[model samples]
Target: MKKIKGIIDRFEEGFAVIEIQGGTKDCPKDIFPKDTQVGDVVYITGNQVEIDKSETKKLAKEIEDLMNEVWED
Candidate 1:
């Protein structure tokens, strides 16, 4: 297994496109939370492009809540 890190380019339906260190790979949506968006740095562990549901969901929720904070509309 290898560690892949990159920024999320796009997320739609149940999939996400990540610009990995070597290349871009399609990640499943379930791995990440419902609120994941573009430009978020993500770390994944796998031989091939795959989604880690637990890890992604946990991080996604945390990021989602943090992004929801607003000082002024």
Candidate 2:
């Protein structure tokens, strides 16, 4: 099956809220890495989810920066 691109909008009750090009879906949160978070882009096909490594790294850094900002003195 063709993989569809999506972004994680949120996670609730162990489900990942994915926002696709034209819609949204709730997938098993465990289908992704433990470090996955909202705004991380991913590719999905059936029950398989493949995260975009570059985008994930970007998001991770963005989150780290945001957290640092929150703790800045």
Top candidate by TM-score: 2
Residue 32, candidate 2: Cα error in Å is: 1.2
Residue pairs in candidate 1 whose N, alpha carbon or C atoms collide under 3 angstroms: none
Judged by lDDT against the true structure, how good is candidate 2? 0.86
| Candidate 2 residue lDDT tens string, 3-69 | 8888899999989999987688989988887877688889988878877989878877998999999
RMSD in order of candidates: 6.7, 4.3
- Backbone collisions counted per model: 0, 0
| Each prediction's whole-model lDDT (CA) | 0.69, 0.86
lDDT of 1 by residue, 1-73 (tens): 6677766888767778888766888888677655556766677765333345566667678877787874335
RMSD of 2: 4.3
lDDT of 1: 0.69
